[model samples]
Target: MNGGVVTDERLQPDYEADDSSINNFEKSVSLKDLEGGAGQLPEQVHTHHGANGEATVYGDFEKDKEQDVEDLPTTTRVVTAQDWSSPDDPENPQNWSMLLRAYHTVPPALFGFTVTFGSSVYTPATHQITERFHVSSTAALLGLSLYVVGLAFGPVLAAPLSEIHGRNIVYKASLPIMMLFTLGAGFSQNFGSLLICRFFAGFFGSAVLAVGAGTNADLFPPRLRAIATSLFLLAPFAGPSLGPFVGGFAAQYKGWRWTQWCILFISIPVYLTCLPMRETYKKIILKRRAKRLGIAPPNGPAGLAAIKILAPYHFTISQVGLTFLAIGLGVAISTASAIITDRTLYQKRHRQALAEGRQHAAPEHRLYAAMMGSFGLPIGLFWFAWTADNGVHWAVPVIAAIPFAWGNLSLFISTALYLVDVYGSLNGASAVAANGILRYSFGAAFPLFTIQMYEKLGTGWATSLLGFISVLMLPIPWVLFRWGPQIRAESHYPTMIS
Candidate 1:
């Protein structure tokens, strides 16, 4: 062991470790203390992605030379970290052909599509649901709120499962269960049954939503990541944007029950893809190989809106659903620009970092176009709010939603990338989980009062109130961008090369 840390020099294969990428080895993970399965992880860690897209992981723990070894069965061996057999190992997800990597990426993204789709599709059916059950319109919205709240907390559980078992298992396990819940929702005879089914559907469906990106990271290395992620991110965005539009048509042509059926029917293909899916996590793959060899190694790894104000402008159920296309327009623009940004700005920074003799680029590079969203989120809200009048053209307020969505999409993507860069894979999900809870919980709780807020305060003030709240949170990204290093240095969380 070098510097009180374990090193797999014997396992280093053809790849050379970029010494610059290695951080303090003694302060990262304590392998002796970690278990065979999912190990306890520190709150934060610094990871430097090397030129080849592989990370050079370093951890601090003295070798347990005195531990018994001879007494173990021949089928068992001391477990240590495993490395790829070679730089070009076909088994490594990072080394998979670009087309193959993308195929893997798309399925999970589509699974995410099903999730957000289910979330918003229910919105257009609210009126029918309220009437059918003799419940207030406010009560019908619980379907949306509870589903989102599940989206929030479901990750708390699923992220760790992905760490322990790999993403495919979670995806495979959650989808059918989610579908079952959706079926229960479609067939529910009572309001309580519908609400219950919606919550459970969201809880199960969120498995893919939570860990799909981790699958992306497993497949794509740093250079191709942004572009791939942009495409992958499009699924969820497109789902929510298109959901109401489609649901509106479904509700019009069929009934509210058809909305639930639509989600299930569309998701069938995503479920089919999982039958051929391969595991992407390298650690889990190595663990499987070790199980065969008996080597004990440790290491584990929206919506809302459109309603009261748009009634006069796009009054028909189908028209209101058509209004959701405005959000789709915004998502499409952001996604296209995101692709361009990936090809140009992201690549430029990647190349520059390599040339400057640094293995990794600063996470702040992601925040450039994203900041306008922070300041402009409120602008978009107010623009749509004030302009949403009876005489004003419906298209005007609809156009306003474009910027709101642009800001929303850019900020979320940028922030997520920042988290992965800052915390790395090991702890990034936890960081994201902490934030997602508040995000989705409020998402759920807000709708409970949103209609009331809009009806009582008028659409202008109600929307403006959301804008105002967004303004209060505006300083968050800036603070992190400006003072991140200092904050990280001072924080209790430890840093690792991992």
Candidate 2:
């Protein structure tokens, strides 16, 4: 007996059974004996014995002995190297090496820079597009406005869908759609057709803008997320700034039609380069792997599928209301600033005259003076509204727009960084969803009222109304800065501090 147990009648050798040996043993074991053994012991006993006659059992079966341990199927979990770590899995995406993450990050940043530039590249082309399409200037401007409108709404679907399917699918799918629609916009024969195509282009292009932020959250840790987000923010704003520069020269030399074609040409190689990048959202990737292994469904009330929809809503209804409120006020202030600038300049001469006479102006005069002269939006809105149509140059109203755009971008940068800082790795799809809702809703509604506002009240008084709204909404950011900790404490979403 090589390594066997000596029983009353025979010695059962502890042979190292390969597949063939196990099969032979199964054939030799009688059904009646197997059934009888099952009641008394395991159907099969796997024993290992040392040369010194020490015996050990590898595992035990209970309740049914007829079934040999060798007959039972062993489940070999195909664990990835990353899954070997703890469930909190700092070694996961959150703890990925800096170099590995930068590889994922840089491409999206490039993609983002390109996409954002595309968004407003048409701004300088508005004059040319107007002439080409035989439409009013305002109608041609709608092409740009509609693109933003698409951006506003694209995230509702793209963000939710990306959560379900993974960021890669959304990114890859939307990029091509964006490229196609952008190309189509160049060929449109009429204003309606051009506006429709441009809108969808913006909508699909928004997938990159909305999803890139989430992708960054998927890669970087909490402390590093802010810097990543800031860099990301720089792309969109910087793109907008640079876009006009390119568009100005393009419109000056190449036709406006060439502008759309130029962007399309630039994006083609970028789309091809992104094809190899793997999905970064952990849940989607793991769930996909688990499916391939034929595992039973995971145990949890909030299953993976539900997370796609629930997570963003959880973040939005909870953390982002203040952010949206702040942004909305900022937008209102911006629109009003155009009107305020005109009004303030008209009052400038009156105020100077009053100063020379040494006459006391009312408390409201100082308040009005403070608002008119300051770089602040509330003042600009108050001034622009009243004086916009009072023989002021169109440049004055447009220049007043500078502060609103600057302030809106600044507030957006701060709020976005704050959200990323507080949310960390969990910020991916949820943050995208929240931001999509916040930005698009405002983007859509803001432009619709802007012209109507200036037309009704004259730029001066129209802006003053907007300034009042901003004043009323000013408490939102203050509250967030003060009570954000308490709000974070109460949130169910994974927060950085936790």
Candidate 3:
């Protein structure tokens, strides 16, 4: 037996483990359930100390005494999960220094940025694609739409996979494949091949869509998560906005195919940089800990923007990409505003919670940023709708995107932080997975109908329609803020919030 750790490798456990050395050695009946990587880990795997003090490995999941997997068979195989050498072990992610944590944190964010960048990066080339492929504009738009829809569906499986495999392996496995498909799209001779490649690229590339928040949870505690989360999230929020900008120039100067080529060039560096990241999931570490005594580890765990040009603007397609920068600029402003709000509002309440001897402030307290920024979407939409005309200077319409971008970032951060606060890491992956499905689904659907809406309803009315939709949905966070505790209690998620 390897280091007194028994193997159920190939679905058979070695009960030869010495009971004496395994003093109080433990686990549930699910050991064999992990045979083909199927089953949940028993609670109370193990924990030592937090960065500050005693920390339970899986948040507040109190362990329950249960039937040992060994007992289910014949002789019992006792295992001491020697996961960490000590409570304050540097290997434990929570104990990592700020620099070390940042090292692990950035790759996922960059990789995510690349994927979102890919989402709309090709949009600037829609005209080029239509001409080359002999397709209509709507069909050309499907390259973007299919990719987003692909992203929406991937979280169904990716989140659970991350929960099982840990975040690093998922990224490693998916990013290269994503890059490969992207390259495939670039080389495709036909529209069918190109669209298929785009969908798979987004599908394989979707790991970050669901796992990023869980990674954030793995590295930083709630108090410090806001700033790090804001920064990490900025890459994604900025991606779609910036994609057209980059793709426009690339397509204009080089060709439509260069849009995909540029993505491959960008993604290679991101993937290569991610190759060395350490695992952050505690269950996986604890599984290895049980493995040192012997065993397995635990289980796991978009976009748009691309509007076209008209007469007064006299903007080229590539310049159209530049105009989309207004949205990116909005994204940047929103991120800055989020960081400021975190310090002024969220952190202040955090300090207050600590003073009250509580571990977390209310999840609803996270809503202030969302509440404040909610106006951006509709306001920007209406502003763009009405002002993006031959009558007004193009800059006026462009300026409208700033508030819209701000509102998007604010709401996104608020939702993410709130969910992370409510669910912690393990379950947070699944929670965020559900969120990803809905989020990307919407991301996918928007581009498909947006142009149609712009055409049928007229840009003014169509854009105003979206604005009105945003206005209607604005009460959601307020309702959550008002009744979140009661809803949270009824839902029965193991929240970290007080």
Candidate 4:
């Protein structure tokens, strides 16, 4: 036996290992200890895209050298990672037609739409809810604030699951649960029931927001991700903004309950539409391949173990904390400018910078508009606060919100893209999870005190308080933009690769 390994009658199929396999091996095995698969013998590792689009890597650790001759199988063929029976494997999502990928992507966006819309749809109905149950405003707002909190934590659990099991199952399982609780909220007889239902609804609905980004990564590689990411990112903010607008009108006309009912009506069709979505996680795709070839799946503990596989990815505390602070400032300031039309102005500036070759220049160049947003956010907030009096035309304050909202959205999208770019695709969901918790938690607490702050201090000073805080955090994006490379160079986080 060569190198203490027994020769088998069969041999591994010929297939070129894809790039992902090399990366997986590098992540899992130390360069000094190249023996594959968890302390087993030097083994053959096969890396390939799994059935559902997840990156799946498998290693055959049970070489015949370790066992008695009688214990070994008499006949076997080592299936290559790309053993798809043919080149254009119908089972491989990477090989799917673009039309099919679009079909898969739309459903997650719609799911994101419905859940995010639900987060604030009941916000305008707060007065009705308070009146119906004889509750105080703070108590009434639990319905909204708690949902925001759910949106924050849901990703902590859901993102890891998508990384493990694939995206479709999370959608299928979580959507129905979210729908059920939403319906319960609609029909609840008391404030307590409504509060409980809304919180759980947010909990379940959050799966789409948490997992959809990963699914997008699964469908579109880095070069093609920008448009899809824009659409996906817009849904979360757009839903909250639109929810209040629709719920305000609907609550005034059809009553508060109709707000919940309308969400259910829209959500049902979206749920049904997503049922046929093919699984997009590559690990799952490869696992299916193993099953077809009569090979055992990878040797590891399942469930939580699957998530632990991603633990090697690391980011600096500066990246997490600074991004969180920046996002919180943007969210708080954007609340004032929800309906502002001028939000696109800075985006136009950002686009101009890109046209001027900033895109090819450096990743930090993407933050030009974000830097502008820092100045504009405080301006918008102070303007909206000071001018938001009954004596003034409503349009004045509304106009003020434009710059603030524009700045907030621009900064947020840029920061998000920056994090995703630096962290790389495999770690994107986890990277987002770190910042999302802070942002959503802040978002939840901000509204609970918004009306109280406005009423107590008047709109001018109340908004000024928020604007002042925005000023404190204003230097974050700018500093990061100017010296980001230096910070990244010194930090433990992965550097951006072109």
TM values, all candidates: 0.48, 0.49, 0.48, 0.49
lDDT on C-alpha atoms for all candidate structures: 0.65, 0.55, 0.66, 0.61
Query: Per-residue lDDT for 360 in model 2?
Result: 26
Residue ranges of candidate 1 with Cα displaced over 4 Å: 1-81, 299-498
Worst 10 residues of 3 by lDDT: 53-62
Of 2 and 3, the candidate ahead on lDDT is: 3
Per-residue lDDT of model 3, residues 424-457, tens digit only? 6445434544565456445433433444566677
Deviation from native of the Cα of residue 428 in model 4, angstroms: 33
lDDT of 4 by residue, 1-498 (tens): 122221221213234466654433322322122222234343555544444322333334343555554443333222333334334555666568999988888887788778878866776677788899997543555576556645654664566566567778999999899989999999999876886688678878888876676677777778987777667666665565567668878888998998899799889999999889989877677676555443455543233213222222222323322323433344444432321312354345447768987553355655665676788889988987777644565456556655775576556545554665566544543454455445644543343344446557865687799899999999988898778878778767676643
- Note the clash tally of each candidate: 2, 20, 14, 16
lDDT of 4 at 408: 63
Query: What's the lDDT of the predicted structure labeled candidate 3?
Result: 0.66
Query: Which residues of candidate 4, in runs, are more than 4 Å off?
Result: 1-78, 81-89, 300-498
- Runs with alpha carbons beyond 4 Å of true place in candidate 3: 1-86, 295-498
Candidate number with the higher TM-score (2 or 3): 2
lDDT of each residue in 315-411, candidate 1, tens digit only: 6435655665666566556545554665677668879999999776677665654665676577788898788854688789888878876677656
**Which tens-of-lDDT digit does each residue in 1-498 have in candidate 2?**
111111111213344435543443322222123223332343344433444323222222342344544554432112331232244444357666777777777667677667766765676677688787776443455566456655754664565556667889987898899989998989988876787788778778877666777788888767888788667655555555566567667877988887798678778987887887778887676565434322223433232213322342343323322322333344445334422532464246447658788332221221221233233556456555554556555445434544553354333333433454466524422452355344534442354345456456654566688788876765555556556667777889876432
